[model samples]
Target: MVTRDDFTEERIKKLEKNLLKVRKENRVKEIANKMHEVLSGKIISVDMNPCYLNDLSYMIKKNLELVREALKKNVSDEGSTSNVP
Candidate 1:
């Protein structure tokens, strides 16, 4: 499995921060797509190291869950407040 610093960690964090700061749903979806891309790449690379297969699966699940929760929160938050100023 890849280390935390190598890929997608920064992208995910940045998108998460931006998700908190922005009210637009489109941006959130875009960021989520970026994350999905990262995950797909990692999964495709899994054959490179059979030893790390379990580790990579666990990390992918964790990260995807985090992204899902954040997106849900953002969606609900938007629903609870004014959409336009």
Candidate 2:
């Protein structure tokens, strides 16, 4: 019983959903890349001593955790706002 208009509408909705998914993926990648750049710079500046290397390792791990949490919060916030009627 579906008409051409109905099919077109469904197609458009699917495309919109895909677009949103792709945009979110791109956003996550951008955040990760920025984080990588910052971490690389920090790593390069650190001294080669064992103590400094250990500290840098810890900092990298902590920063990665923070980035994950931030990205999760961001994605959740975006989902909540984007789905508004």
lDDT per prediction?
0.68, 0.73
The C-alpha stretches of model 2 lying farther than 4 A from their native spots are 42-63, 66-85
Off by over 4 Å in 1: 1-49
Say which candidate scores most in TM-score.
2
Per-residue lDDT for 2-83 in model 1, tens only? 8868568878989898987785566455545644676667334534555344444555687789989999999999999996
Supply every candidate's count of residue pairs whose N, Cα or C atoms clash at under 3 angstroms.
0, 0
TM-score of each model, in listed order: 0.44, 0.50
Put down candidate 2 lDDT per residue, 1-85, tens digits, no spaces: 9999999999999999999999978865655564476666733444456754565466568778998999999999898886658
